[model samples]
Target chain A: MNIFFFHLMPYGDLDLSYTDKYDSAWVTLPNTYFDRSKGTAIYDRYIGELSLADELGFDGICVNEHHQTAYGLMPAPNLIAGALTRTTKKAKIAILGRALPLVNNPVAIAEEFAMLDQMSGGRIITGFVRGIGSEYFASGIDPTLSHARYYEAHELILRAWTEPGPFRYHGRHYSFDYVNIWPRPVQLPHPPVWIPSQGSIETIEWCAAKERKYTYLQTFSPIELAQKNFDAYRACAEKAGYKAQASQLGWAIPTYVAETDEIARRELQPHIEAFFNKFLRFPIEMRMPPGYSSIASTKMLIERKYAVRASQQTIDTLGDLGMCIYGSAKTVREKLLHHQKEMGIGNLIAMLQIATQPAEQTEKSMRLFAAEVAPYLRANASTAVAAE
Target chain B: MADNVTTETVDVRGLKLKVQQAGSGETILFLHGAGGSNWTGLLDRLATKYRVLLPEHPGFGRSQIPDWMMSVGDLALFYLDFMTASKLDNVHLAGHSLGGWLTAEIAIRNTTKLRSVSLLAPAGIAVEEAPFGDVFLWNHEQSTRAQFHDQALAEKRLTVAPDLDIALQNKSAVARLAWNPRFSNPQLPFWLHRIDKPTLLLWGREDRVIPYACHVPYKNGIAQAQMETIDLCGHAIHNEKPAEAAAVIEKFLSGVKA
Candidate 1:
C-alpha cells in the first residue's frame, strides 16, 4: 500500500472565536481574522513540511484547491505543487486537484500540468474536481451548468494532452483557437489522473468507465458511505466489461497516531474538535448551494454528511463513523489494515496534519505515522487482515 | 373570492406548463416569485375583477424543466411564446421578485400585447447603496424569516409548511437564472426605458431580500412607472400584505383601463 501525505494548509493561527461571530470558517468568515504577519511564514513552513513528507519516505504528497475561505489557504494548488517540485525529489506530487469547470481555459491547465509534470520529472498525478458549490458563489460560474462544464473541460484537457495541437478545440463552455500546450508532458499519453470526491454517483460512474478508469479516491466520508461508493465503482467497472483493480480504489482520511491510544485522543481532541466544529460548519445553502450536485447526490450527501453538522460532532462520533481516525500506532494500523482488506483500498492518503494542530504536534504525528503505522500497512498489504 | 379556479396544462415549446386561472374580464397574466408558490390570496383578490392567470415557470413547482431552459432570459422568451400560444391580447403583465425581473425583461423586449406591467419587489439590477440580502448565505429558516417583516406571520408560515427539499429545488432553478449575476442583470437599467406601457413599481419598506434600496433603479428608469411602498412588509409582499397589495394593484389596473 502506498501512503500519501495530504495537506489542506489551513490557517493554523485561526481565532476559534470566529465560531461565535461568523456562520462558518468558509466564504462568509471576515478576512479581518487572517493574521497577515504569519501568512508567508505559514506557507514557507507548510511547503517545507510537504518536502519533509517526501524526505520522511512517504510515497506521495497531495495538495488541493479552495477559494475565499480559511478552510484551505491554497486557492491555487498548482503553484504550491510547483514549489514542492523544487523542494522534494522522489514523491509523487498530486494536485488533487484543480477545479475543472472554474477555469475558463482548460488548455492553460494542460500547459500547467504538462509543465508541472516536466518539473517533477514525470511524477505528477493530476486530479480533476468539479469544485465545491461555495466556489460557484465565489467564481460566479453557473452551478446548473457545473456537470456539463466539468465533463467538457475534462475531455478538452485530455485531448489537449493526447491529441497533436495547434488544433481547433471547441466546446459549449470553452473554445480555443490553438490546442497546443508548450511544455509537453514527460509522461507519455499524460500523467496518472486520480479523482478525489465525496463519492458523487456520477463521478463514480465516470471514473469507472472503460475508456478512463481513473483511481477513485473517497475523501472525508464515513466508512459505510465509502464502502458503498467503492462497491458502486466496482459494479460500474463490471458493467463496463472490466474488473476494477484494488489499486483503483483509495481512501483519503485525516489520521493522528501516538505511542498510546489514550495519549493520541487526548492530544488530538481540541484540534479535531475545532476542525469539525469550526472549520467544517458548512451551512446547507453555502455548501450545496442550488443545483450544485444532482438531486440524487444531494440527497445522498445530506443523509450521510450534511444531515449532522460538524459542530455537533466530536472526535468520538467522527471516529466511530470512520470520518476520522486517531489512536496508538497499533489501533490505527489495525483499523487501516482491516478496512484495506475489507474494501480493496490499495492507496492510503493519510492527512497527518489536522486543523489547528500545532506545528510541533503535527510533526510528531507525521513522524509517528511514517515510522510506525505506515510500515505495518506496507508489510501486510495483500494479507487477509482480520478486524480486531 | 371566486369558485371557478381551474388548472390545465398548456403546451408551450414542447413542455406541459401547469397554469392556474380564475375569474373573467381583462387578462392578468401573473408570474410568481422565486419562491414559486401557487394561487396566493393576492391573486384571489385580483381574480374578483380581472381574469388572473398563473403559469408555473419551467423547473418550478409541478412544471417540468425543458432541456434548453437555462436563464431568466430564456424563461422570459418562453412566457412570450406562452402568451402567443394562449392567444391572449391586451394582457396585464404582473410578476413578483424573480418574476418581476422577468416582467421587466419581457416588456423591454416587446410590449405590443401588454397594456401595463406591475412589478412587486422587483430584482433585476443591483443596488450599490445596500447589498442584496444574500439568501444563498443564510440557512433556509433564516432566509425564510428574512422574507417577511411580520415575525408572527413568518413563524405561522414556517409552522404550517417548511419543506427545505421543495424549497431547495425551487432555489436550484433560481440559481440557474440569477446565480451568475447575483440576481441582477447589468443591462436591465439601460433597457427599462423601453417598457413604456403603464407601469407600477410596488416595494416593501422593510424588505430584506431585495431591499427597498433596489426600487430606485426601476422607479428612475421607467418613465411611466409610479412607485408605491407598503409598511410592515418584506420581499414577499403578497404573503405579508396580500389585501393591501391587491388593493393598490387593483386601483392601478382600473386607472390603466379607464
Candidate 2:
C-alpha cells in the first residue's frame, strides 16, 4: 500500500506565444524550442517538495531514464537516485530502471549499481529495462537483437555481481576474456531486480523464471490490458511452482490527487496530451524493431486489439486510457483497492508529475495524496506494507 | 557506367530491383541507409574490388513499396528471399544505420548467407549515458546544431531547403514503412546475441546522432564483433568520412577470406 512518486522532468513554459495555437501546434518540435533553463530550478523545487513526502511519511521515491528528448531529463536515473540517497534518509530510492543491455561494460553497471545499493544501505530497488524504441535509434544498436542482448547483458551483470568474477564469459552475444569485477555488491545476490515493462509475454516469462520483481510500465495501456498482463504473470509464476507475491509485480501509473476526479482530470488533460504527443510518439519500426519482439508480437501489434487500439488513439485518449489516475482521496483509494483486488499488483508507482501542469497544482496534488489517500491504504495494508 | 561495369534491372523474387554488378572476386551485397538509392557513393567504392550488388530496397528510389510488406523484419526477411532468388551464398554484407541494423537482423536469423557482416554507425543496441539523436525531430538548423562539430558543414547538410518537399516525400515514404517509435522496441532490447556472424562495428567518435561509446552494448552483446572508431564523423560515417569508413570495411573484409 506504499505510494511512490515519479517525474519525467517535463519542460514547461508559461508564456504562450501569440502564434502558439495550442490545437494546431506540431508537437514533434524539440523541447529546447521552449525555455529549459528553469528545469534545474523546477527539479530542485520538485525534489524539495517530494522530499517532504518522506517526512510526510510517504513510502518511496522513484526516478527513471530517457535521453536526447526533454521528456525525462534523467538520462542517468541512477545519478538522481544517488542524489536522493544523500538528500533523504529513509525513503527507498527506486531507480525504476537502467536500460541494462544498452550499457557496454556491464561490469561498470554492476559496480555502479552495487555502489548505489551500498550508498543507500541496501535501500536500492533496481529496475532493469531494455530501454525503449527511440533508444535503438539513439544507441546505434539494432532493435532486432534487443531481447537477446538484454537477457544476455542482464545475465552478465548479475554474474559480475554474484559470481566471484575473473571468470571468462563465452556468451552467444557478449564475451570477455576476463570476468573479474571489483566492489562486489553488499547484497547477497545484488539488490532486487525490479522489472517494469508493458508486460511483454517474453519479459513476463523471463521474470517469472528468474523470480525477479516485475512491474508493468504500461502507463498508456488500458486497465483490461494491465489486468490481462498481471494475470498472465501470476499464471506463469504459479505454473513455475511459486505463489506470486504482491511485492513481485507493480504498476507505473500517472496519478493526480484533487478535491474531486473531475477537477483533477480537467486540470491534467492538456499537459497530459502535450507530454504524450511531444515525447512519447513512436515510429512503427522503432516500436517493433526487428527481432526485439517476435513475428507473433509484430502480427499482434498490427492486428490485435491492443496493438491497433494503441496505435490509432491520439496521445490524449491514450493517456486517459493508459496513463493517469485523477480523483478525490476516496476515489483514489477505491481505484487502488480495486486494482489490488482485481489485478493483485501490490506496488503503486505514482507519477507525481501528472502532466506538465502548473507547479503549484502538481505540488498540491502530491500534498493532498500524501495527506489524504496514503493513510487509508497504509492502514488497510494486507501485504508487507513497507516502501520499496 | 564504366566499360567493365554493368548495371541491370534484375528480378529477385517478386522484387524488381536495379543493381550495379561488377568485379569478379567474393560477392558483397551493399544495403543503403535511409533516403538512399542503390548507386550510393559508398557502394561505388566497394564495387571496384568485389562482385558488388547494390539493390534498391522496396520504397527507396525507384523501388515500389510492396503491398505485402509491413515491418522492418519483413524487409529483413526479404533480403534473405532476395539472396535465395539471386542464388547467391556466402556473401559479405555491409549496411549503414538502418541498413546496417537490418543487415544484423537478417544475419542473426541466417548467418549461413553471410561471409561476414560490417555495420557502419549501425542502429540496434541500446546504450545509456549516450543515446542516438532523434533524426525525426531535427529541422535544418536544429539538425545542424545537434549533429556536426563544424557549423559550416552542418549548415550545408542541414539546409534541405529547396529540396525540402522532395526530402519530406522521401522521409514520409520511409516513415510509412518504418516509423515506429524511436527506432526501438518498446518492449525489449535482446536480439543482438542471436547473431552468429563475425561482425565489424565502425563508429564515428563525434557521432552526435549515435555516439562512439554507444558501441559498448553491441560489444557486450555480440560475441564476435570487433569495433573501430573513426574521427570527424556523425551518424552518417559513410557520407561524412567515406575513405576511412571504407578502409575500415576493407580491413575487416581482408581479415576474413572474403
Candidate 3:
C-alpha cells in the first residue's frame, strides 16, 4: 500500500487545562491562549517534518484547512502545500483541502492550485472538501447553501482549470464573468482530484460515479464506519457500471510506533487523550449546523456516530474502535495490513505528529515507521499476494 | 377561541400557502416572525376587531417554498406579487421579527396598497452598539427561551414545539434568508424613509433577541411613526404580552382608521 503523511499541524503548545474553563477548543475558544513564539516554532518544525517525510520516502504529504480553531493551525492549507514545493521533492503535495463551500471565489483557488501544480512539476493532488459545519459558522456562508455551493464551486474550479477562460461562468451561488486562468495546470485535464471526507454518503456516491471516479479518503473516522462507507462507494460504483478500484480508496488515522506496544501506548497516551478529550470537545450544534446536510444525511450521521461524543472515548476504547493506531512497528504494520486487506484500501495516510507529541519523539516514531513498517507494507502492496 | 379562525390554501407564483384568517373588518395581514405563523393570542384578539389574515410565509407552516424564493428579498417580492394578485386594497400590514422586517420591505417598495404598517421587534436595521442577538447560534431551548421574558412560558412553549417537519422548514427558511449579515439587511435603514404610510413600532423593554435599543433607528427613520415599549417583555411581544400588545396596536389601528 502507498504510505502518505497527513499533518493537522495542531496547536502543540495548547494548555490542555483550557478545558476546565472553556466549552471547546474550536471557534468559541478564546484566541488569547495562543502563544505567538510557540506557534512560530511549531509551524517551522511541522513543515520540517513534512520535508522529513519526503526524505523518508513517503509517496505523498497532506495538509488540510480548519478555521477559528486551535485544533489545526492551517486555515490555509495551500500555503503549507506551497512551502512543501520549495522544501521537498518527489512526494506529492496534497492539500486535503480548501473548504469549497466557504469560499466565494473558486477561480482564485483554481489559480492557486494551478500555480502549485506548476511549482511542484504537476505533483499536486487536488482534494476538495465541503468543510465541516463548524466552518460555516466561521465563514458566515449560509449553511443551507453549503451542499449546493460546494457542488457549484467544484464545477466552477474544474471548469476554470480545463476550459479556456474569459468564459462567462455563472453559478447559483457565485457568478464570474472572466473565467480565464493564466497558468492553467501542469497536469492534463487538471490534476488528480481526491476527496477527504468524514463519511458522508452523498460524498461517496458522487465521488464514486464513473465520470469522476475520484479517490475517496476517509478521515479520522472509525474503521468499521470507513468500511461501511467504502462498501457504499463500491455499491455506487457498481450502479455506475464499474467496480471501484482499491487505488480509489484510502484511510487517514493518527498512528504512533515505538519499541514495544506498552511503551508506544505510554508515550502516546497523554497527547492522544488531550487530542480527543480536550481539543475535540465540540458542541453537537456546531458539528452539524442546521441545513449543513440533507435530512437523510444528518439522520444517518446521528444514527451511526451519535452514541459517543469524541470527549467521552478513552484511549483504549478508541484503539478498540479502530479510530487510532498505536503499537510497536510490527504490531502497527500487522494491524494496518489486516485493515488494508479487509477494507481493500490501497493508500494509508498516517498522522505521525499528533496533539502535543514532542518534536524529537515524533521524529523517532516517524523514522521507525519509515524504516520498518513502510517497507513491509510497500513490499506487500497487494493484499492478494499476502493472502496467498 | 379558534371557532372563527378559518383556514385555506391559496396559490401564489405557482406555490401553495395556507392562510389562517378570521374576523371581518379592515384586513390586517399579520405576518409572523422566524417562529412561523400559528394561531396565537395576538391574531385572535386582533381578529375580534379587524380581519386578521395570517398566511404562512412561503417555506413555513403549510407553504411549500418555490426554488426561486431564496432570500428575504425574494420573500418580500413574493408577498408584493401575492398582494397585487389578490387585489387587496387599503389593507393594514402588520408583522413580527423577520416578518416585521418583511413588512417594512414591502411597504418601502410600494405602500399604495397599504393603509398603515405595524412592525413588532422588526429585524431589518442594524444598530452599531446593541447588535441583534445571534439567533442562528442559539439552539432550540436556548433560542426559544431567549425570545420570551418569562422563562417558564418559554419552557412551556418548547414542550409544544410545532410539527418537526414544519419547524425544520421554518428554521431552514430563516437561516437561508438571514444567515449572513444576520437577520438584518444592510440598506434597510436607508430605505425606511420610503414608508409613507402611518407606521407603528412595538418593542419589548427586555427583548433579548432584538433589544429595545433598536427602536432609535426605527423611530428616527419613519417620520410619521408611533412607537411603544412593553415592559417585562421580549421579542415575542405578540405572544408574551399579547393582550397589552394587541391593545396598543388596536388603539393605533383605530386612530389610523379615523
Candidate 4:
C-alpha cells in the first residue's frame, strides 16, 4: 500500500485546561487563546516533519484546508503545496484539498494548481472538496448552494485546465465571459484528482463516474461505517461499468507507532482525545448547517446520531472502535493491513501528527513507522498486485 | 374555532400545492411562515367571519416544489397564479413571518387584487439596528421556546416530534429562498410604498425570533399601514395568544375600505 504522511498542523500549544470554556475549537472558538510565537514554531516543526517524510522515501505528503478552526491551521493548502514543491523531492504533494465552493473563482484555483503541477514536475494531486459545513459560515457562502456550487466549480476548474483559453462560459452559479487560464497543468488532461469524503453517495458516484480516486476519511466513526461506505463506492464503480482498482480507493486515519503498544497508546491517546473531543467539538447546527446535507444523509445522520456520538466519544472508545490506529510497528502494520483488507483501500494516508502532540515525539513516531512498518505494507501490496 | 376545514391540492405551473380552506364569506388568503402550514386557532377564529384560504407554499407541507422555485419572488408570482387559478379577486391577504414577507411582495406587485393586507412579524424589511434572530441556528427546543411567550405553550407545541422528511423539506426550501439575504430582501423597503391597500402590522412585544422593533420600518414604508404590538407574546403571535392576535386581525380586516 502507498503510505502518505498527513499533517493537520494544529496549534500545538493550546491551553487544554480552558477547553471547557468554549463549545468547540472551531468557528466560534476565541482566537485570544492562540499564541503567535508558538504557532510559528509549530508551523516550522510541521513543515520539517513533512520534509522528513519526503526524505524518508514516503510515497506522498498530504495537506488539507480548514477555515476559522484550530483543527487544522492551513486555510490555503495550495500555499503549503507550493512551498513543498520547492522543498520536497520525489513525494507527491497531495493537496487534499482546496474547498471548491468556498472560492468565488474556480479558474484561479485552476491557474494555481497548474502552476504547482508545473513547478513540482507533475507531482501534484489536486483534491477538490465542498468543504465542511462550518467553512460555509466562515467564507459567508450559502450552505444550501454548496452542492450546486461545488459541482459547477469542479467543472469550471477542469475546463480551465483542459479546454483552450478564451472560451466563454456561463453557469448558474458562475458566468465568465472569457475563460482562459495561463500555464495549464503539465499532466495531460490536468493533474490526477482525489476526493476525500465521509461517504456521501452522491460524492461517491460523482468520483467513480469521473474515475477519480475516492479517499474515505475516518472522521471519528467506527470501522464498519467506513467499510460500508467503501462497499458503496465499489458498488457505484461497478454500476458505472468499471472494476475499481485498489489504487482508486484510499483510507485516511490517524496513526502512531512506537517501540511498544503501551508506549504508542500512552503517547497518542491524550492528543487523539483532545483532537476529537475538543478540536472537532462543533455543535450539530454549526457542523451541518440547514440544507448543507442531502435529505437522505440528514435523515441518516439523525438516525445514526453521528454528531452526538462524535462529541461524546472518549479516547478508549475511539481506539476500540478503530477510529485511530496506534501501537508498536508490528501491531500498527497488522491493524493497517486489516483495514486494507476489510475496507479494500489501496492507499493509506497516515495522520502521524495531531493536536498538541510535541514535535519531537511526533517525529520519533514517524521515523519508527517509516523504518519498521512501511516496507512490509509496501511489499504485501506489490505481491498482491503481482498475484492479481 | 371552526371545525369543518377542508384540505385540497391545487396545481399551478405544473406544481402541486396543498391548500386548506374553511368558512364561506369574503375570501381571506392566509400565508404561513417558514415553520410550514398549520390549521391554527387564529385561522379558526378568522374563519368564523370570512373564508380562510391557507395554501402551503411550494416546498412546504405536501407541496411539490418546482426546481426553479428558488426565491421568495418566485413564491410571490406563484401565489398570484394561485389567485388566478382560484378565480379570486379583491381578497384580503394575511401572512405571518416568511408568509408575511411573501404577502408584502404580492401586495407590492398586485395592489388592486388585494383589498387589504395584514403582516404578522413580517420578515422582508431589512432592519440594520434590530436584526432578525437566527432560528435556523437554534436547536428544536430553543427555536420552539423562542416562538412563544409561555414555556408551557412552547412545550405543548413541541410535544410532537418533528418528522425528519417534512422538517428537512421546509428547511431546504427556506434556505433556498432566504439563506443569503437572511430572511429579508434588501430592496423590499424601497418597494413597500407600492402596497397601496390598507396594511396592518402586528408584532409580539416579547418576540425573540424577529425583533419587535422591525414593526417601525413596515409601518413607515406602507402609506396606510398601522402598527400594534400584542403584550406577553412572541414571534408566533397567533400561537401564543390566539384570541388577542385574531381580534386585532379581525378588527383590521373589518376596517377595509370597499
Alpha-carbon shift of residue A90 in model 3 (angstroms): 1.3
For every model shown, what is its TM-score relative to the native structure? 0.96, 0.61, 0.96, 0.95
State candidate 2's TM-score: 0.61
Screening candidate 1 with a backbone cut-off below 3 angstroms (N, C-alpha, C), the clashing residue pairs are none
Task: Give the DockQ (2 decimals) of all models.
Answer: 0.70, 0.04, 0.58, 0.67
Alpha-carbon shift of residue B130 in model 1 (angstroms): 2.0
Write candidate 4's Cα lDDT for A218-246 as tens digits. 44457887888778877887788877777
Give the Cα error of residue A22 in candidate 3, in Å.
Answer: 2.8
Error of 3 at A351 (Å): 1.2
Q: How well is each residue in B1-258 modelled by candidate 3, as lDDT tens digits?
A: 479899887777677778889999999998899988878998889988988889888777645556676778888888888887777889999999999999998988889899999999999887888888877667678888999998989989988845656666777778888888888888888888999999999999999888889888889999889999899998899889999999999999999989
Q: Residues B126-176, candidate 2: write the lDDT tens digits.
A: 566776676654534665565555567667765554343334434544553
Which of candidates 1 and 2 reaches a greater lDDT?
1
Docking class of 4: medium
Q: After TM-score superposition, what is the CA distance of residue A53 in candidate 1 from its true location, in Å? A: 1.0
Candidate 1 CAPRI grade: medium
Tens digits of per-residue lDDT, candidate 3, A1-388, equal 6799988999988888887887788888999889876777888999999999999999999999999998999999999999999999899999998889999898899999999999999999999998887888899988988888889999999998888877998778899878999898999988999999887778899999999999999988888999999889889998999888888998999999999999999999988887888777676667777678765565556555556544377789789889899999999998888888888887899999988899988999999999999998877767442322
- Please name the candidate that would achieve the greatest DockQ relative to the true structure: 1
What is the DockQ score of candidate 2, to 2 decimals? 0.04
> lDDT score, residue B166, model 4?
87
